[model samples]
Target: MTLKRYNMEKILKIITGLAGALFALIGLGWVIKPAAIAAEMGLPLLEGTALNTQIGDMGAFFFAGGVITLLGVLTGKRQWYYAAALLIGTAGVFRVLAFTVQGATLPIDKLIVEIVVLGILLASAKLTSVPQ
Candidate 1:
């Protein structure tokens, strides 16, 4: 059998880096046009000053998380990777909390998306610790 070599750390590094990039892009979208983005995500785009305020607040949160994740990607630190995972996992946790409080009114689709994101972030963080 021919020998095959796999540089797992290198592959995971790239994958996590790309994940950070995606988060940054998504944050930018929400920041620039939260209404349109939220609508596309199947959330109602509310109106009024409160709507703008809420969207801005949430957009800033996303932007901060995304930037931090990108920094983790650049630094190649295991702590940074876990930090990113924590950021994402918190989102999923909050979604579940909202679902519990709001009952069936909570959107099913968004819950699904949050779960997927949490899974990816957790998996990435776990893989980052693989022995070299």
Candidate 2:
């Protein structure tokens, strides 16, 4: 392999690893301290069943995405990356829908991060291949 290509791969791996780590930590926060994480996300954690759903559902969503992303990077499995991309990309689409149809404010910050992560996962999936 060329030196430049080798370096580029290294950089991409580093970026993807960081993203996975950050997401996992955020997921942990959701489970351990749902109130703070919910506040940060501009969400409420009301009492009773709603609070349970907020913590359980959101925690699983983020933790699964992070773990799958890490699996892709560690195992050199393109399918895992594709899975993460699909999950995150779908969330991005929802953000757009909320803004356009649900009368919610534009979530530019979250959208930007989602788009960048989606790009990274898709690119990584394309660049890597599974053994035949």
lDDT of 1 by residue, 41-126 (tens): 67677779877876776676666667766676566555666676777777777777777886635666766766665555555555
Give residue 43's error in model 2 in angstroms.
Answer: 1.6
Position 131, candidate 1: lDDT: 28
In the range 1-132, model 2's lDDT, one tens digit per residue, is 688767766777779888988888788998899889989998887789888887878888888899989998898888889899999999999999999999999879999999999999988887764541
Per-prediction TM-score to the true structure, in the order listed = 0.73, 0.93
Kindly provide the TM-score of model 1 when superposed on the true structure, using C-alpha atoms: 0.73
Clashing pairs in 1: none
Give the candidate number with the greatest TM-score.
2
